[model samples]
Target: MSRIGGQLASRGCPHQVKGTTMTTQRETGTAAPHRVLILGAGYAGMAAVIQLAARTKGCEDMQVTLVNPQERFTERLRLHISATGQQVAEMNIPELLEGTDARFVRGWVTAVDADAKIVRIDDNRVLHYDTLVYGLGSVADTVTVPGVEEHAYTLNTAQDAEVLAERLARLDRGTVVVGGSGLTGVESAAEIAERYPGLNVVLLGRQEPGAAMSPKPKAYLQAALTRLGVQVRSGIEVVKVLPDSVELAGGESVAADVVLWTSGTRVSPLAAAAGLTVDEHGRIVTDATLRSVSHPDVYAVGDAAAIRQGFGVMHGTCQGGMPTGVHAAVSIVRALDGGQPKPFRFGYYHTPVSLGRHDAVVQFTHPDDSPRRVYLTGRVAARYKETVTASPWPTYGRMKKMPASGRYQRETYVGPWLPEPILTVGDTADDITNAESVSTAMLVVLETLSPLERAVFVLKEVFDFSHAEIAQAVERSETAVRQAAHRAREHVRARRPRFTADRSRQRDVTERFLAAATGGDINTLMELLSPDVTLWTDGGGKVRQALRPVVGAQTVAAWFAAIGKVTYQGVEPADMNAELVEINGGPGMVFSGLERIIATVTFDFDADGRITTIHNIANPDKLQAIAGGITRDVGTI
Candidate 1:
C-alpha cells in the first residue's frame, strides 16, 4: 500500500478492500457476489459508482454496477453551452469504468422493488441488488403548465440541448423566451442572446433574476442580462405556452420562436412506487444518514433525496449532491464492515452564474445559500464560474483512485468539507481566478504561509471579507486580523513569481522536451532543463521508483536516457503514447505503453518557462485512472 493508502488503513478509512470467494458468473455451489446496484448516473450516482468501484477494486465478493439511460456522461451543468452549439468533451461511461470490476448497464429504469430489492430496467430486464442506491435525479417541471410538455425546450440532457441547438440554428431572426428567472433561466437567456445576437431573448419568471442573491450581485446579474440584450420580465406567471409564444397570467402574449423551460424540478416517481417514504414533491424522504426513513436498505442521493439540514431540506444541486453520494458510499462500506453509518451534513458555498462565455457573477453564500455580501463579476468571475462548472467531471476522474482526504480547519465550523477543490489543468495567465484573482504561482506561494495568515489573506483579499468577519474565523480582534492580513499581503507581494512567457511558447518547449526524453535524446533534455532542476517520482508504493529526489540536469537527463534505451515488460518506446496534457494547471505528459499506463509527468517552470520540477507519477493504481482522467467535463444531478 502507498503512504496515503496506509494512512487510510490506519485511520480506518471505510474503503478497506479484501478479496472474496464469489466469481463473476453463475458458479456451481458458489456464493453470489455482493451486488451494489446504483441507478441514475448523475453527479451523485457517478460519485457512488467511482467510490464503490475503487474501494472494491479486485474484490471478488463485491460487484458495483451502475445503470444509466445513456452511455455518454451528461454535462448537466453546461447544457446551456451545448444548446448554443458548443461541443463539450465526450466522456464515455464504460471507458471510464475500464479496468475496474464495476459494470455499466445502459437502460432506462422502469420500476423498483423495495421488498425483493429487484430493479426493473426498460420493463424487460431485472436486476437484484444486495444494496440499492436511488439517485434518479430530477428533470424540469414541464407538466404543471399548459402545452409546456410539447412546446418548450429543456436543457435536461445532451439530447435535449441538441434539439434546442438545432432549433436555434434554424432560426435566423426570432425571439427566444426563457421561462423562469432562476440561475438556470438567467444563464440560458444570457447564453442564447450572446450566441445569437439577432435573436431577441426574454427572461420571464415569478421573481427577479438572482433573487436569492444579495442586492449587489442581484443588481450585477440584472445589469449583465441587459448588457446581453436579454429582456427581463419579472413577477409574471406563464399561464400557457403557445406554438410561437407564451401567454402570461395578465393576458399578455410574448412572441417567441423558441421557449426554454428551467422552472421547478420534479424527481422520478420510482421511490414512491417502491413504498419508500417520499416528500410531497416525490423526492425520497431520508434520515440524517441519507437512508430512506421507510426503507433502510435504500440510500437516496442527488435531487431524488429530500435530505434535511438544520436550515431546511436540501435542494438538488451539484455541490450538495456529490457530497451526499460520497457519504453514502462511505456509509455503505461502513455498514458492510459492521459499523454504523454517520449522519450526512453539507453547507452551500457559492452560486456562480455565467452571463455568457465572456462574463459572469458569482455570489458568495452562507451555509444556507443565502448570499453573503461578497460577489464577483465580469470576466474574472466568468472564468471562476467556468472552472467550477467544468470541475465536477474531472473531479470524478480523480475520485476513481484516491478518495480525497478531508482536512478540517482548527477554526470553528464553517463550510462543509468537499470532494476536492477544482484545480484546472494547464498553465496560463487565464488560469488565475476564483476572485482570489491570484495566479496559480501566487496561490502556490501562499500555501507556504501560516494558516491564520493564509485564511486572513484569502478572506480579506479574495472573498472581500470585512475585518470583523475575518476576526470571527480566526478568533482574533479586528485590529489583529487586519495586521495579519497586511503582513500576509506584504509576504506574498515580496516573493510572488511572474511568468511573461505565453502558454503556447511554454507548451512548445514542454512538448519538445517530452519528445526528446521519450526518444532517449539526452542532449535535448539537458538543454531544456535548468542546471539545478530536480526530478520527483511518486511511485506510491505500487511501483518501483526513486525514493529520493534526483537533482542536476545532467544526472536526470542521463538517467532517463538509459531507461529509454531499453523498454520494460516487452514494451517498446513506440508503444508508449507520449501525449502532452495539462496537469494541475501546468503542462504535463503521459507515457502509456501497450500493457499499462507507464507514467504521468507534471511539470513546473521558472519565469522563463524552463523545466524546474517534474512530478512523474508511476503508481500502478493512479496511472490507470490518469489514462481516462485527462479528458471530459460537466455532469448531471
Candidate 2:
C-alpha cells in the first residue's frame, strides 16, 4: 500500500461528503487522496503551496504537489541585482516543502489538459489533479520586436541573468542599451552604469522613468539616473532590435554591444491552449474569488491571471500577487468545507523603485494606486526597497506556522471598538434625562477619543463613578484617570453639538438619502449631504472598504453612485430592500437581501437637519446581531 493508503487503512477510511478530498473515496471503494497540482512555484505559487500545506498538514485525504523548472526559488524583485553579477540568497523549494504535506517536483510543464484535469510534464509524465493553481508567471516579451528573441538578453530567470552577467563581465568598453524605461529598465541601466563605469549605458522608452510618481519623487529618480552617468531617451519607440543596434521611430539606431529588453511581459499559452478562458493578453480570466470563470476548480494567481477589482483589473506586482495566492488557498479550503468563497478585494498601497545598489525612490499611494504626496528617496528608500524585496520568504515561513482560523478571525469580538447602543421605549414621552450621553452624535465624538479615555469618560460621566472607582474599573492610576477624564470632557464639550433632528424629520431625510444613493442620483445626494460630509465605512479590515475617511460632497456622492450600479454579496440591485428604521434612538437605514442584513447605515445630523456624517457598518460579524429585522414595537439595542 502507499503511505497514505496505509494510514487510511489504520483509520478505517470512512467516506466524507463535506470535503472535496473524500469525493474519490465515495465514488470508488478504494482510498485515494485529492491531488492539488500547483504550477510555476514563483512568489505567488509558493505562497499557495505553503498556506495549503500548513493548513492541511495532517490530512491524509489531501495531497499537494508543486512543479517548477528549477528547485531554487527565483527572487524576481532582486533580478536586476543578479543581472549585474551581484550575489543574492538562494532558497530551495524542496527544502521549504520539507515537514509539510506538500511535495516538490522539478520539471517543466509541457501542457495542461483542462478538460481532463491532467498535466503533462516535459518527460511525458502525466499527473491528475482535482484542482490546479496556475501561477506560471510572466516573462519579458521577446516576441514583440524583431531580433529581440534572437539577439537581446533578458532578466527573466536566474539562468538568463547569469548569462547576461557573463556577457557584461567580458565587455570592458561598449554601449549597453537597456530597453523600456519602466522600473526594470531604470534599475538595469543604473546597475550597469554603476558596475561598468567604462561602458556607456543608455535607457530608451516611451515614458519617462517614475512618471507615475508624484513630482518630488519623480524628480529625485531622474536626478539619480543622471548622476549615475546614464543617458535616458524618452518618448521614443523601438521598432526593431538589431544585434549591433536598435532602430528608433525616426530610423535612428542606438549603437549597443549589449541590449537588455525589459519592455513588456508575456504569459504562458498553456492556459489558453487548455481551453480555459483568457483575456486579450493571454492571461486566465478569473472571477472575483480568483477562480477561473469557466472552470471553478482551477484557481489562477500572479501574472498568470487577470483579476478585476473596484479600481480596475490588477497589474502584476508581488504586493498584489501574493494576496491572490493566499486568497485562492482560503477559497479552496472554504469550498472543500462545503461553503461558498467570499469575493477578493485588493488595493495598491505603495510603489518602490530601485535606482541602484545604494539609491532608490519609494512612492506612497492611495488604495486606488494613485500617488500620495508622501515619498522617500536616497538611501532610506533603498533600504526600504531591500527590506520589502526580502520579505516574501520570511512571510511564507510565518504563514506556515499560523493556524488557519487564527489568520482570519475578525469575528472573535475584536475590531474598532464602539459603544453599545441604548434601548428606549418607542412611543413614550420624550422626557429622557441626560439624553446626550446616549445620542448618536455623542457616540461619534466618543469614537474619536482614545480607548482608555473613552472608557474612563463613560464610567465617570455616564455611570457616575468616582475617580478611584473609575481607575479601578479601567485598571489605571487615579492621576491618569483624572487626566484622561479632563481631556475627554474637554474634547467632547468642544466637538459635540447640542442639536439633533426629531425622529420623524430624520426618517424623511433618510428615506430621501437612500433613494438618491440607490438611484445613482449624484446631484440629489450632494444636495442632501452637508458640504463637509464624511463617510466612514467600518469593514473591520475584513472586506473591501476605504482605508481612510472619504471626505467631500463630490467624492462621497460619486462613491455611493457607483455602489448603486453593481450587485453586492450576490444580491442584485433590483432585489435589494433598503428600509428606514430606528437605531440607537435615532433614524437609520438597514439594507437587506437574500433574507439577511447586508449592511446598516446610521447618520449624525447638525442643527440645519442636513446629514453631516454617515456611518456604514458592513462587517458581517457586526451585522449578525440584527440579522432578524428590528422589533415591530421598537428598535432593540
Q: Which candidate tops TM-score?
A: 1
Q: Name the lDDT value of residue 424 in candidate 2.
A: 29
TM-scores of all models?
A: 0.67, 0.64
Off by over 4 Å in 1: 1-30, 405-487, 491-637
Candidate topping lDDT? 2
Model 2 global lDDT (CA atoms, 0 to 1)? 0.78
TM-score of 1: 0.67
lDDT of 2 by residue, 1-637 (tens): 0211122112112224355347566467665777788998888898899878866777777788999999999998988889888988899888888878798888999999999999999958998998899999999999989999998999989988999999999998989999999988998999888888899999999999989998878888898899999999999899998989999988988999999999999998999999999999999999988999999889999999999988888999998888888888877766776678888877787899888888888887877899976565665567668889999998887566542321333223333433432222353334323344466667778889976677668767755778886654334578988999999999998877544536566667888888898889999889878899988776666656665788988998898786568988778888787766666656677777665556778777777778887777776545533442223233222
Overall lDDT per candidate, in order of appearance: 0.76, 0.78
Where is model 2 more than 4 Å wrong at Cα?
Answer: 1-31, 403-414, 417-637
